[model samples]
Target: TALAENHPNLLASRHQLAGAYLADEKAIVILKKVVEMYETLPEDHPGRLALQHVLACVNLRDGEPERAVAILEVVVRNAEALPEDRLNRLVSQDELARAYLNAGQVKKAVAMLEDVVRIRKAQPEDDMNRLSSQHYLACAYLAENVVEMMAKVVQKGPRRLVS
Candidate 1:
């Protein structure tokens, strides 16, 4: 904690600590402080965006889907400059879709997850990210009463399931 306070520019320690406490409510406090420290950074700065993403996850864990959605919306927008295959952008989109789902915006979640699923499809079928997007897309479809779409996603399951 002292080190983090002393070297405000050094986010690695603070980030790790925040991650360690993510399951605890303390994570929100820690992450908020770290995010504030990075306020001087540009909105699209990778470090700042990454911190925001973690903060959003903490919000999600605390059942504050609206907050998560707000943070992730910005993260996604800023991440547009990154490559399409960048893990951070893909993961941010996935989390944002989840935020929409939890906030009862089922249609928005379905639409967002559809894009994520489409992008992940180009990756290896068994890739964790691809599978996760597919799973969430299924959930979104289920929530939106699109049972046929859900069934189609299920049919395109990972190789192990297909076998």
Candidate 2:
């Protein structure tokens, strides 16, 4: 709370506190406040996008896949509009794929993951993004047949795979 007061303008600080709260039972309350703060920002503001992404994650964590899919759809659209090389764009796409899977949209998730895989593969061979994207793509494929295959599932990460 002190950080929130001391750095009222620092969205990241508030986001950190919100994330901490989101890890526990108070997630609903904390996420609501953070989402509200983010919604007040301009559409193009990075903080708004980031907050929307966080809300999407919270929605998923709360077992509300439909809500997550809804939020991720907007995030994915905005991310796709950015340059192809932008890390946030790729990360958003990946997250959207995860949301789709969580929402039981397997084919849709596969399509998005395939797109990410293709894009990453087009980058330099040494790029970690290429490697990790390939891995996630594979995992997504496995996820589609998980019921039959009986395999463990892997979730997407929020961090950029490449530097």
Candidate 2 lDDT, tens digit per residue, 75-153?
8777777888688888888888888878878778889889888778768888887777777677778877874443322
Residues 70-129 of candidate 1 have per-residue lDDT tens digits of: 999999999989888788999999999999999989988999899889888899999999
Give the C-alpha miss distance for residue 73 in model 2, angstroms: 0.8
Clashes of each: 0, 0
What lDDT does the true structure give each of the candidates?
A: 0.88, 0.76
* lDDT score for candidate 2 against the true structure: 0.76
Error of 1 at 73 (Å): 0.4
Q: How many backbone clashes does candidate 2 have?
A: 0
Off by over 4 Å in 2: 1-11, 123-128, 145-163
Error of 2 at 72 (Å): 1.0
